[model samples]
Target: MFFAVFLHVLAFAFLVVGRTLAPRNVPLLRRAVGDNSTSSGIASLALDKSSGSYYTVLKAGDSYFRVALDTGSSDLWLISSACTSSQCSKVPKYPLAYKSSTFQAVNNNQTEFSASYGDGTGVSGFVAREMVTVANITLKDQAVGVIDSSNVTLDSDVSGLLGLGFPRLSSMSESVTNSSPFFSQLAQQGKLEYPLFGLSLNRFDNGSLTLGAVDASVVRDVNQISWHPVVEFSPFGMESQESSYLQWVTPLAGFGTNGTTLSPNPSYPEITNNASLALLDVGLNGIYGPYSDVSRLFEAMDGARLVDSEGGLWAVPCDTKQNMTFTFGEQTIVLQPSDYFLGRTSGSPNLCISWPAAQSPSADGVDWHIGTPFLRTVYSVYSYGINNVEAPVIGFYPVTNSTTAQADEENLSSILTTVKFTPPNSLLATPTDTILPYTFNASVAAPTTGLVSTGLATSTYSPIFQAWTTVRSAIPTIAPSYAVFTDSSGAVVTSTPSIAAVTLGSPPGWTGPNGAGRSSPAPIVVTVAILFAALGQWIFCFIV
Candidate 1:
């Protein structure tokens, strides 16, 4: 009888395991082949270590790590170590109540969540209540989501993240039972003015997030600036109900010599509507979207080229002219030469810089992205309070003399150069054993149909694991040359090596620094512009 019982148990285990292991393919893998079909959430934030320009932030618990905010996603999450659930254990985790006297968890039940990465990395974790604070606002007994894992590799130094965009791309909608995000809570309390908040991301070197009130010092006169109403939406479309996203008109008055790029021809050649709220963004990186008119404006004036990322193709160029200007509503502001910034890429061109462009998709007429690529041009402000209503609107102003723009790039270069990369221990050809112990009596098998299951399951896995061996085994890329500012006369002053100059397999036609000289006899010419608040309905940014 004992022998028979043992044999039966073995057969049951095989039956369960066979069902799950025998599925020919995974649905997540199939969906991943598409261009925009991805689960890795893109987000943005301000880098505190060096430049103040807002980038992206990633989150795990009570902690919020800065990352690149993205409009391409609909969910929000942070990597954490505290989350022991199989889902979250792969990424870094932060202890919810570690150091906060104000920390209190309204709910502490361990829940599982799964999210995909840009390189096809995915992790699952447990969710619970966490005490969190943003700026000076402390959230007590806040229902927080937690992921407890450290198996996934990170692209940069973001500890966690805060997602401040739209609701349609929210993780709360998927896993949490009864919880509202921080921004929504602020709106409920009527803590903001104009029922909105504004964002002002200065050039990458000198940017800062202006929440609630205007800095006043940066602008000529705050009272002279005209305010407008924010747009509203339901789900993915415009709705009858008032929206929480701040919408305002761009006042073009104070911009310097170059004048408003949108054109003053009364026809708004570049912009079909100046009343559009494309610039309203609080936690985003900078102005992003497909604006053909704006693209032509920059192409004609600054000589920028269009580029692409997960967000979409934006403008990128080798060099820029100084003293650029933009006007909003009744207010006009001018940006000096230094406000423009540059970027580097791992793919094609080793060095990628920001440029202005206008593009629209077939489904959406006017799609604008306020990302870091655009934010680095000016100082930004956000007022969570407006019209006795507490929504958020983004406001912009020029940034000067601050090291905000240069800092993020310099720091990013430093982090990448300094950190050492390590490969995972095991490389499996097919699906390997589960990292976490299986609790069910039978192995969970993959379904014959529908790659769609809401709950976190063993079947949900990242495809990046296949490439781990290839990437880890290869040698790191190195830059070949350095960039040195130069004058028309070709004299050198100061020089810095280019990251691309050292790395291999980087973008082609890599030019070290311009050979003219180490320094430009001309002063570092710059311009500064501002962008405002982003919507609370979507994922805002990502950590690099």
Candidate 2:
């Protein structure tokens, strides 16, 4: 009997080790395993006071500029001048100022290169780099890819995106050999106190990005557990093996009621499997993972189909309306119907939802991406590691309504209004204007004046033509604006005040400045040009 028991024990040990061991690449079955635990003891420090800036550097012409920083995608690229295509000129262009400075363009004479997004959006540019300065810290000699396009979604405060991730794969990370990733560099230099970063995405400002430390005031317990290096090559191989990280797990008492009580896991009484991991991301705007399992863990009101964009996984439309609840440790969060939809379909009366479904798979198992929807719902913290693995705690704060859905019913708007502008035309000069063709840049701001909600206007009125300027000036609201007007008087009024504010649909009485035509060129200016000296330096680095 004793011998038999020893053999059984040995067999069990082998099973655990075999299950834990995995290949360099992630597996499909492993990622499908149901692991609903939340990683715990991770606290992220808050740095709401700092300004997040996205800077750009051109390679083809050795130019540099600053744009907005977006955490929605994983690519460090720029727009260059060599791209003489009409579309390239329309987007923001980099100035040729590096000719006087010591910069390098390692790539060839090819004026354009292609950078593809998970979405259908792709830009062409040349890859180059130079010493970049951020928060007083200057990195000498870095690699940057410069593309050409004017349709980029950059604002005045937002110049370009600086993706903060592990090294080896990142353009900024691999380019600078001595310098580590942006966040890693800060931690190594002892610039951060807790080795963590925090983010509070608001409707105002450029959404907050805090580096170097976690906000202690926002977290429950600080020294709850010992930190470990982040695990690469997990069950699905979603992470890169470039470095070490940790995932904090906790055993919950149980699933509770009213979002407060914890129940017992009858199958495993003493062992709770609620584990949560720290995700250090800057390119993605939202918290990601399975809606029913990892990340949010909340169920939608209705079942939706899964749609896969070229860039990432998205939710599909479903015929039935549904509702469900998710229990995250002590926190219980609920999602609304509109939160599930990405946009409204023109053919159908319903909206197109945006959520990740379990059906899709990328080259590497089932990939996960945190999009803008998720970002708007959480207050995430990313901690920079100090002394390599010894870092502060990281935290994930769910954006709860604070008050229940019943509390703020009055503030929510059932109808949305947008604005638009039109050129000075006959409608304003002469009355009885009938159906006149109109068009505007929906990618920019909505129209603000001379908007029409219904039929053609008979009265002469001029619509505001500065929708682009007004929308660009909006501080933090992502909801693009629009313009509406009544067609009482109809001559083309390029500039008139007879407009009403509209929430949905096209701006009223407004026409594209270029009129009703598809082939309109965007207006992008290449502020100032100095010289192309950086391109020459970059060539020398590759030759030697």
Per-residue CA lDDT of model 2 for 1-544, tens digit only, reads 0001001111111101001111111000100111312111111111111121212221122223333334332234544444456544433344333242545665452433344443234455565555554322344554555555534333221224455544333444433344344444444444333244455543222233444323333333333211222322122133332223222112222221123333322221111122322233333223233222321222222333332322122332323233223333444434433333333333332324334322121221112333333444455554332232122233456654532332121221231111111112121111111222212111222211212221111112111112222121211111111124333365322211111211111112324231111211122211112112211110000000
Model 2 TM-score, all chains together? 0.46
CA lDDT of every candidate: 0.32, 0.30
Residue-pair clashes per candidate? 189, 125
Q: Candidate 1: which stretches are off by over 4 Å?
A: 1-76, 82-92, 96-126, 149-157, 166-178, 190-211, 216-221, 224-228, 234-287, 302-324, 332-338, 341-354, 357-359, 362-366, 385-393, 400-544
**Candidate 2 overall Cα lDDT vs. reference?**
0.30
Per-residue accuracy of model 1 over 1-544 as CA lDDT, tens digit each: 0001001111111101000011010000001112432111111123322212233322222233433333333333455445455433322235443433543343344556565542234546655555454433444544454555533433223333344444434566446654445544444343322122334443222222222234333454453333322333212333222222312223222222344345432222122233233433333333433443344445554534444322223333323344445455544444332333333344433233433323332121123434443444444443332222122233455444332223343333432211111212233122111123221121222111112212111222221112122121111111112245665667653322211111111112323221111110122222111122221011112122
TM-scores for candidates 1 onward, in order: 0.47, 0.46
Model 1 lDDT-worst window of ten = 17-26
Listed per candidate, the RMSD to the true structure in angstroms reads 22.8, 25.1
